[model samples]
Target: MTASPNRGLALTVGAILAIWGILGFFFAGEGGHAFFGNEGGYLWGVFLVNPALCLVWTLLAAAMLIGGLGTTIGSRNLNLLAGVVLLVLALYGLLFMNTSANVFALNAVDNGFNAIVGFVLLLTALAADRENLRALRADRDDLDALRAEAAHG
Candidate 1:
């Protein structure tokens, strides 16, 4: 069977997010710093990199990867929804980076990263949808052409 247009990209993004989340836990205990820099008691520079965030990332990653791999209608819808959710989260991070209630410790760096990832996911989903539509249209056109040829011959 033909692979989905965004399957490879979704898999790569899922793997990266999963690995990053897992690595965040490495410094979960006391004295743990953010992965890139010390921020919010995390080894990384992002906001509080705790077990909870790691779990969230892992779950999101699993959803994206699994949905991309599956051929069911539910899976395709899941993939699209995941992309939309990521975009929304990124927008939230960027818009509330300096708010007092910003408990996620999302700084400019983290927000930027989130925005980039979200954009990538959104683009991949749109591209995939476009490709599928194009393929369907091509198939329809080919069928029509064949019918015409047979009728005239």
Candidate 2:
């Protein structure tokens, strides 16, 4: 029942994204914008988003929330996974920011934000839970030694 920093981060990010995702629908398609169009309105006058992006955000948020509410290991793993995915998505979005391939309606701001969040998640997952990591490593080492002794015997 150890509390993970990743859990806190996941919960906070998940909640914020959930709220943004819901509000995003209201401003998604402004003036006949396509569902996956490059053109989109800003969420809270900051992050550019469309229906597709909102859906993606909502899905990610759900995952984060669920992970946060689960075991510490679950949160850490989820953060790692989500961070990698977000980083890749951010790179893709940045590359196709102004193209028709930008189905998520991602802009520079969104890409930047995604990159930042991704990095944060990744770093936290790798750096946090030191005690658990040490214990796990120690357990593995002990297991290895036991196995070696059993094989020799």
**How does each model score on lDDT?**
0.64, 0.87
lDDT of 2 by residue, 41-151 (tens): 888788889998888888989999999998677898999998998899899998999899999889888898889988999999999987876786798899999999999
**Index of the highest-lDDT prediction:** 2
Please state the error at residue 118 of candidate 1 in Å: 0.8
RMSD in Å for all candidates: 6.7, 3.2
* True-structure RMSD for candidate 2: 3.2
Clashing pairs in 1: 33-42, 33-43, 34-42, 34-43, 34-44, 35-43, 35-44
* Error at 53, model 2, angstroms: 0.6
Q: After superposition, which runs of candidate 1 have C-alpha atoms over 4 Å from their true positions?
A: 31-39, 43-48, 72-76, 133-153
**In model 2, what lDDT does residue 138 have?**
91
CA error at residue 127 for candidate 2, angstroms: 1.3
